[model samples]
Target: MGALFDHLIAVPILLPLLAGALMVIVDDRRRPFKIAVNLVSTLTLLIVAITLLMIAGGMTASGDPARTSVYLLGNWPAPFAITLVLDRLSALMLVLTSVLAVAALIFSLARWHRAGPHFHTLFQFLLVGINGAFLTGDLFNLFVFFEVMLAASYGLVLHGSGTARVRAGLHYIAINLSASLLFLIGVALIYGVTGTLNMADLAARVGDASAENRVILEAGAAILGIAFLVKSGMWPLGFWLPTAYTAAAAPVAAIFAIMSKVGVYVVLRLSLLVFGPEAGDSAGFGAHWILVGGMVTIGFGMIGVLASQGLSRIAGYSVLVSSGTLLAVIGYGTAPVISGALYYLVSSTLTISAFFLLIELVERARDAGADVLAVTMEAFGEDEAEDAEEEVGVTIPFTLAVLGASFAGIALLLAGLPPLSGFLAKFAMIHGMFNPTGLGDGLPIGAGTWVLVALLIVSGLAALIAMTRSGISIFWASIERTVPSVRVIEVLPVLGLLGLCLAMTLQGGAVIRYMDETAASLSEPAGYIESVLTAERVARAPSGTPDPAQGADEETEVAP
Candidate 1:
């Protein structure tokens, strides 16, 4: 058991991979058993995630950052082998993804899991790819994991057939396939120039790469950046996001809140690693474009929110806002800004996930489509309706009160209003925008920083105004507003998500500290490289190439 704990990094990937495969073999008639497998797997993943973070933070029984886990596959050298390394950044992502998996899976159990075939299988595979992407240290392996994630997503995006879903799925599939092609092309160019697919090796080689190779690397980086930008929902390229997300079932959309962030994660990981201080003239190769593009993305998303009519569209635009803000923070590339942005990332993701789940419940009362999912009042496990049989009264009842309360919390979070995590996150970001030192001696706020500041405020205001309008339209303006019948399972997941956000708010200091540390670790890549390139890391890894005496029996399956 003690030894097993040392190699825990691989479990996030393996657990999901195994579970998804088993789910594929399980017949759909075994619904209860399927749900059990999914629930147990996701819950266990949540546990593993927390453990990985604790281990990284030195909060576990083994206490040291040097003890941060690295697993090399095939027992090959780092430059040639596949590797999965869990640093502060990757560990943080695993924890986040797991928490979301638990919430989204529980929410889906309410009904969406039964809506189509192999929903459970696809979901677990999605997790497998996402976890693998976050963990892998090799760029080629990253591509493989990306394809797995995308392939799974193609099925998920079309899980429940509708004309709109089919249309959106087709567009989504086409764009992503093209993006994948770009991703492959970029990887090929990088590998051709550098002769290594391992990210650590790439970083180690980049600083000293030849002038001609630098040109090749730059082009490869540009092409790769396009793929990431498209995935992250950066302008023009992300027009498909709103439509696709809106058409997706509630639970799918809820989980997809993290999809855009995956692109940001890759860019953040690769950019600083490959182009940091050690990279000489290329130290900040693409920073300017990222800065300009992030601002433009924010502007585009804001406009979409203002012009949107429905709740789903508004939520879709919010993804853009979240993505743009994170992209801009990455562009800023300051430790402090990245710190605050990390907190903002958590706050906004949980807030939006809850909002997506909540939207289905709220819309069920207003739209006939939602009514299709409606069941008897007893299905809610309540003796009676939250209100007096939908007859409005002077005093608010359980359903009304809950929706109102959740609405207020979401509004505060999304709008960055006071007392909530959203407000705290934005305040931290705004305060750190210039990194003030003394009364007259703060880091001089740059013009671009000011622009970011203005956009932050404007985006918050746009969100506030839009949310308020939607709330009134759904909650108050409708003279004959029917109370939505929500199941406890469905509502519990939303509450769990929002509660997590609130908990993050209550414990902002520790969380922010972790984010700060994670940012610092990412900003400097030396330690990360050292951890991956050690001889033990490459020559003695348990999962990759085996020694000659050990033979094929010792070797395990790795992605070809």
Candidate 2:
């Protein structure tokens, strides 16, 4: 049973991998097989959720102490082998990813069946890569998982490949491929200097390196950071995001909601581990740069959102804004701030994914062709039609009303209004910035305080104004044509995602606590290193060279 728990580390990745392969093999005509695959995905998600709950419970029970779990592939040791590791942070992320994956799958069932053969296969493979990326503990393995996810995403993104989608997909592929190359080069450099690719091991060793070696490590880390930044849709590097995300199919774009987070996850993990306070004076270097870059990203995204005319593009810019804010919080480098950032990460990802889903629904309903005015007209027509049909009152579907209300709520939350998860998350971060602790007071008293204050005010205002504009355009304006019916597939995902955002808002405390624990674990890298090395060693059995077991073990360890 204990050994089986170790296997739990790999289940999230393996289930999807096997499911994808099976999906490819199963005839499309075999409805049962497809149903089984869906069942498998749902069950896999349930397992991941249960596992995370158990882990979170354990962490809470232990008084929030750092805990680690190791899964050794083929029963070999690490360094000479590979391993899988899970901690608070990775567990939380895994659960989040699983939830989103299930939602995405459910959303796709109706529409994606019409897409083509092996659509499910591509989706499952993408999940495999995503789950693998979240769990793995090695640097090189991270790149591998990234490639896997990117490859899967390429197919998914270009699935329908209308002219616009194809063009966007090409741009997405080109940029990400370039980023991947940079990632590889950075990894090679880091390996050259540190002689180790294990993240935890690297963290332990990086602090001890000579000054010159530290310089090399920082340079490598910077390059790696750039790769992640591009993925996260940070300023300058993220021009490809809006078009790519906007042009993707609804369900495909929904999956992409998890995509940007992968970059944020890497940035959060690497920054906390590789450049933590323990890295001594060198730690501050990357932190300052991230902070500056994040601020710039926020400004850029804000301008884009305010100026954008299309709903999809607006949503895309919103993603950039959310990413920028989270990154900025991370740049602050305090435990409280990180906790806040983590909370915001959860809220933002859920909310934005929901937002995107809603945008798709609205677009479909209005036959709006992604135009802002068209969406507005549909909403208005629906409202007017309801008024006209029933002298007493036309009964709008409670689901539709709830969806609209939820979008409005999310807008409020994004604006940092009180009594919402977004506000709480931002408040927590602001609190951390002003009152520094273990994460350090990275900013100056007068200047930093003012800057943060300005950001808070500006961000809140920007969100408010943008939402107001979008809301008026979507809900109040008149439509020139009859609204189209929304497909069940699209509606289900949007509702599910919106429900999640609402739940997060209601359960902010629990979410914050989970994030706090996760951040703490990330700040302390010893347990992660031990688990990965332990698993790797158990898997390899002194193989003297990298092999399949080593690869598998490494893959498992990199999940978080």
Candidate 3:
């Protein structure tokens, strides 16, 4: 059981990979079989992910020596072999991805999956990419996984055939292709300079790298940062995000809410672990750029949300704002602030994802032509008489009630309103910002700090106003009200995501504590480094027949 359990960490990446390939071999017409495979694969992943999350959080059934676990592929040694590491951060991301994958897959079964062939296969491949990215312990594998994810996303983004989808998908593909090439260049430069692609190894050497090597590494990092920035949707580099997300199928868009965060995750991991204060002369490199860019991104997103007429675009901008907030908090360089931002990351992601799923349903009844006019009228307070066709009814229907309630919940969550996890996350961050203890000497809360606070408040205010206006137009100012055909499948996924946000709110204390610990673990990567650097101690066998090892008195201690 011990040896077998130790190997389970590989399942998250492999299960999805094999399932996707198998599903691809299954004929596209075999809908039932494909759906079954997709469902089973995702469910299994969910269970495994939850178990791994517990193990990573130090709640394993038995031994829990360290919070980081490393799984070597093909029984290879560390630094010279492929490795997948499970720490609090990676495990949290895996669980989050699995949860979203399950919900989105279920929701797709309602109708979206039928839009085109191989939807299940693409989704599974996307998971393979995402899970691999999270668990991989090396820079080369990270690039590999990133490409896999992006490739799957290109197909998913264009799943539903339409001019808008095609256009957005093309632009997305082009931009990401450029980014991928640059990503390769950066990886090459780093590998050439450092002589090792293992992330732990890089972190160990980068701090003490020779002056020439440091210059080359920084150049590579600059190119790498552009790829990440493009993914994170930071201001100018991101204008494509809203378009692509809005054009995608709802479930695809919902899953894509986390796609942007992949860049955020990488940035956070590399910045703190490799280029931290421990990096000597190169310490805190690019931190200022990240801080400034994030601020600008937030301002950009706020404006987009306010200016946009469509609910999808609004949700898309909300994603941008979420990314900006997390990035900015990361730049603040405080553990408590990072913890709060982690909370915000979860809360905002769940909320925006739910909102994306709900938007299509909410808009199903509207005049297809009205989408543009709706945005136009909502953005500019057009002084026009209420339409003669506008019909008002005192009676409320089930679907309308559901949509209204969901919209209100999204507003509260995204706007950081009181009595929600969003508000709590922001509060914690502000508190941490004002009090950055243990910076050797005290660093004053400067203008940027105040700007961040003000931005948080103003952005919340902006989201509130935008949501209210859109809600009124969508729910109240309906000229032609059609009770949307709401499927149980569609609603359940959205509810599940929102419910998770609610759960975070309900258990804010425990969740934040977990995040604080996560931030602490991220701040100090020694556990992760040791697990990845050391040979995983496995049970040794005798020269003859292998039985639980001849003289083994104690179970071989390995990373949990």
lDDT of 3: 0.86
Candidates' C-alpha lDDT: 0.83, 0.74, 0.86
Number of the top-ranking candidate, with lDDT as the measure: 3
- State the number of backbone clashes in model 3: 1
Off by over 4 Å in 2: 29-32, 56-66, 367-400, 438-444, 481-484, 487-489, 530-560
Query: Candidate 2's C-alpha lDDT?
Result: 0.74
* RMSD to true structure for each model, in Å: 6.6, 5.2, 4.5
Tens-place lDDT digits, model 3, residues 125-174: 99999999989999889999999999999999999789999999999999
lDDT of 1 by residue, 86-203 (tens): 8788888888888888888988887888889999999999999899989999888899999999999999999987899989999999999999999999998988888777888788
The regions of model 1 sitting more than 4 angstroms off are 59-67, 368-393, 436-444, 535-560
Error of 3 at 178 (Å): 0.8
For candidate 2, write residues 210-327 as lDDT tens digits: 8888788788888999999999998889999989999988778877887898998888888888777677656655777777778888888888877776767777887888888877
Instruction: Name the top TM-score candidate.
Output: 3
List candidate 3 stretches off by more than 4 Å. Answer: 59-65, 371-393, 438-443, 537-560
- Rank ordering of all candidates by lDDT, starting from the highest: 3, 1, 2
Question: What are the models' TM-scores?
Answer: 0.90, 0.87, 0.93
